[model samples]
Target: MEKTTRAAFAFLLAACAPGVFAASSADLSVTGSITPSSCIPTLSNDGVIDHGKLTAKDLGRVTPTLLDLAEIQLEVICEGATVFTLTTFDNRAGTSAINPAHHGLGMINDDQKLGSVAFTLFEPVADAVPVKTIVSRSGGARWAENAYLGHEALTSFAAADGPNTPIAIEVLNARLRAFTIIVPARDLTVLDEVPIDGQATLQLKYW
Candidate 1:
């Protein structure tokens, strides 16, 4: 009986060997594009939007209060006229529990909800031409106008479609309408003054 059981166990081990249950391989269709020139993008004041010092009392006791609008001049200087669009990576991702459009203000911890900031992109001009912002969710065959640029189709694939016409630009200019909103004072546990640390990275999506 023991020899029979051992034989069965050995058979099971052989069936479960490394190559016995191999996963089927699938083809990885790689695709990419090569662009001719590059661009140097910069923001005014090094892209810093300072909210400055704000007392807890300055924040509303209950309702969210909007801070003064901070502006950062957006400019992209290119080697030649090239098609490109911009995308934003939330530096403080997942910290914005309240709003998706609003980038995060760093938390005090896991529980305490900090504040949020939302910005708008406007006045886009490329190569001295008013290159109005447009989006194509339909694989670049058609494009519809889109003013917003927070992780929408404007920033995803359409921005980098070289074969299809992308936004042509040797130089690009735009303005960020940034507004910081402070949470209600009572919602936070105030042992001392806290710094509002909010950040995001704007990437130039190109082909």
Candidate 2:
């Protein structure tokens, strides 16, 4: 009887060993590196472009109304000569009356889109040398000169005589022109004071 009991206990232990020692968890790791170089970007006028007050009568009744053109100076200073690009983010995303490429001016009545703003970069100078503006729609895989800086595109500067490739620069200065358009008045509710709220952020990306 003692031997039989001992054998039964050993069988029970073996049967439960796998259930007690089985792996029921896993580990995940996240990692990234911080570059020693950094860049800072600034815009003129504290990055504010006020369209001023406009009455409902000033808006277009059937067609989209074109607002005045605004220009701001963009400057980028790097810790050292670095290859980088500029990308834009629309704070008022998905509200553009036109398309995703354009930045949005807030909506009206909670659902009706108000308008959009388009940006273009021109007259870029790098390290005191005149450079051409280049844009990459494929996340820096390929580049083209004098293209519109859409929301999905990256903007960089290249030497005037060089091919359409981004270059390293310590300082960069360029002109950003903003073209704004309001949706047709018929599509919006202008009963109250509707503000034109358009905001965007320009980001510097290492190439």
lDDT (tens digit, per residue) of candidate 1 on 82-152: 77666678888877645777788888856776888876767776666665666565545666666555544
What does candidate 2 score on TM?
0.83
lDDT of 1 at 124: 71
Index of the highest-lDDT prediction: 2
Tell me the deviation in Å of residue 169 in model 1: 0.9
Candidate 2 — which residues are off by over 4 angstroms? Answer: 1-34
**In every candidate, how many clashes are there?**
0, 0
Q: How many steric clashes does model 1 contain?
A: 0
Q: In model 1, how large is the Cα lDDT of residue 168? A: 61
In angstroms, the error of model 1 at 163 is 17
Candidate 1 local distance difference test against the native? 0.73
TM-score of 1: 0.75
lDDT of each: 0.73, 0.89
TM for every model, in the order presented, reads 0.75, 0.83
Put down candidate 2 lDDT per residue, 35-144, tens digits, no spaces: 67899999999998888998888988999999899998989999999999888889999999987889999988999999999999888999999999998888889998
In candidate 1, residue 17 scores what lDDT?
95
